[model samples]
Target chain A: MSKALLQNEVIILDELDRQIIQATQSGLPLVPRPYHHVAEDLGVTVKEVIRRMKAMKDTGIIRRIAAVPNHYALGYKGNGMTVWDVPSELVNDLGHKVGVLDFVSHCYHRPRFLPDWPYNLFAMVHAHNRKEALLLVDTIAELLGKHDRGHDVLFSKQILKKTGMRLL
Target chain B: MDDLDRKIINLLQEGFPLTEEPYADVAKQLGIDESGLLSRLKSLLDEKILSRFGPMYDAAKLGGDFSLVAIKVPKDRFDEVAGIVNSYEEVAHNYHRDHDFNMWYVLATESPEKIHEVNADIEKRIGLKVFNMPKLDEYYIGLKLTA
Candidate 1:
């Protein structure tokens, strides 16, 4: 009956850290020495910039410095938010199982609003088309087996906005 | 995308090196020159193949709060409600989906209290109940999509 949310140790960001975030939140400068460019812009040394970034990364403030591909552009057009109304007792375990699937991008145990919404387990499935996405959902359903009370897939009709989290 | 582009995407997704000459270091590993690697990355981003190329920050870890919220908008009033919801700076990644709870978006704020405040404000403005479904448990995240 543990409904504890996964909490990471929050890190207090300093002024320079905030500045770094602002500078790089949109993107890192596409240059040979991108960190050095940021340092120059912020009136700090390259070493200082790298040190602060490393610290932030180590503390989990920055998940990772990497490239995020556009799924649609990559031909993953069938994006389905598959939600399941699984037994509360088995949600966490089932979520882990679904999450490890190659096609499942995100899996989480969320609060269920009964009467209207019964889904507590949410998994995002990506595929090349609707048929493929549904097939992937079947894979999750098979994996869940008897625990899969019921589920529904919500395909995105339109992307109104997708700016991600911008620290303002 | 060619072999080199695929290679860059796969390798970069793993992580970009944090160093004085990070791109150079990566280039050496890819057996390409520093300038060549940079150009390929630039082209990938410009061509919209790569949505983003930077540090993905964990807002919660950085002392911020975020939640997934949905509002069942009337079909006729969808655009109006969407405009109102999207007007808020806190609202990120809004989508129209195929369901009764059609309008779903994520609210990321600098404080946990702000999450509630924003949700309440949106409900009041739109005259619809905003269903806030925050994660009680994150079983897993970060699926590396192969190029």
Candidate 2:
């Protein structure tokens, strides 16, 4: 899905765009015509609802309107936080590359503290169990040449939260 | 009003009704009018204070899988790579976090098998090695944003 467009990207979020984004992302009403329900509640026409959303899409704000699965209930045993010591020059390039993979869920770049923490890149890997999680982590480290540089793997001791962006 | 907003958020986060008029019902529960509820909700959404108020499905329950992945993208070429990966139907959300591996995104599909297929396809299409790390365990998964 699309994310917040850069200001230089010629994006403008008007009132209607904000309204529809607020309506849809605030969780879909579990009805048949979700948009209709949202439009009615928001005191706007359904056509306007869709139109504004489309506008947001062109401007680059609203990402996706899909069901976010509950991984915990699926017997996924762990959430591992893995980091990679990728070259500073290619951190964004590599991060974007890794993000396209389905196995890697949430990836970000954190400041690198050398001598103490050598890993320059960070990624969150979710699996059914530790073995599978480690398999992915170790494979990533190997491919990224962790031994040659230096990296760290800190298992997600806790998930502070997991909520996507909203219009507000 | 903020207290009421917080309460509504707490209730909806737990689960939204699948009714024809869910907000009306949510308003009824809050002892407020539907229009009033909508107005307040409008303010909350406009502020970017609330992340989302939608269905949280069980992907594996519905025969699907997903994972969070990240890669170190070149600064100058972020928009380029993000455009490529975000183009994929399987990709959900992409972000440029402030760090080394700045570009991160999530993917979900109908099956674990598809997870591999999509990622592999992305690797070939992007010509980059994807570090696939699935979740091993979960300690906590929540954020008190309204507060």
Candidate 3:
């Protein structure tokens, strides 16, 4: 594990925390008092459920308790997995700038298999169509400027399987 | 979707307020009644526009490990190899892409060490090298799609 992740492992969740996560991992029921339902199911008070969820969010365990929109269903037909060949020394700064763009959803610095795969920076961009997605890619290219050595957009052909965020 | 539905989606994608009356707060902001907001959200979910409506947890932070693995599956054996790879419950998403390393999947396990074990099992069964690419650094991971 990386030093950063190892350090984060220190914050362990208790049994109650695990129970809460297990109960709500799929999703929170869309009721007037969703937490109340979860609390009752887990044999806890509504206040306790909210407190634990808030704590989890504060600790970065929960990014956000929000609605995850389906880009494709929302008329975003063109989805591009754009990869860039960026210099290792400048990836951190360049990645930050690329990530801040509204169109780019996910940005990460991954290892490259030299000779075979030269791209190290991955950013996913979504748009109404292929043209729009490429335009977004061009915008990213403009942002990278001198740091971007090369880039390519790999549009997914099909989804063989998509079971969103399942962990038991 | 109508303008009102789009507006609700745009707002909710950012986040839902954490309070006793969270729906009321969001409804007030959107200029709609609390019941209307709830029913709209329900309909969006029912229509399959929103995959889910709840807290988005960080798997890694919750003591789970996630890795992106790619494989070069020959056209003839692609289906067979995919079955072998997808059989494992740890595989969350398997996507067919247009590239030499055409098959890509995300694997989630309880621990970091299990990532290697699962990869080994996959490679052994498929008779192909699995390029396990775990994110060295995550710059950002939020996708907000405005309708």
Candidate with the greatest TM-score versus the true structure: 3
Q: State the lDDT of candidate 2 residue by residue for B14-106, as single tens digits.
A: 444544456787779989988887777666655545544453323433234666666666778766776787877777665555455565667
* Model 1, span B1-147: residue lDDT tens: 999999999899889988999999999999999999999999999999999999988777666788999988999999999999999999988999999999999988988889999999999999999999988888666747777
Interface RMSD of each: 2.6, 13.1, 1.4
Off by over 4 Å in 1: A1-10
For model 2 chain A, where is the 10-residue window of minimal lDDT?
A: A1-10
Off by over 4 Å in 3: A1-3
Q: Alpha-carbon error at B140 in model 1, in Å? A: 2.6
**Best model number under DockQ:** 3
lDDT of 3 by residue, A1-168 (tens): 343775855767899888888888887787887888888999989899899999989887788988888988898989989999999999999999999899989999988987878999999999999999999999999998988899999888889878877655
True contacts kept of 3: 0.75
Error of 2 at A159 (Å): 4.2
Computed on alpha carbons, the lDDT of every model, listed in order, comes to 0.89, 0.58, 0.88
| Model-by-model DockQ, in order | 0.67, 0.05, 0.75
lDDT, residue B37, candidate 2: 74
Q: Residue by residue across A45-90, what tens digits does model 2's lDDT show?
A: 7777766655544443433333233445334555666777777777
- Model 3 in CAPRI terms: which quality? medium
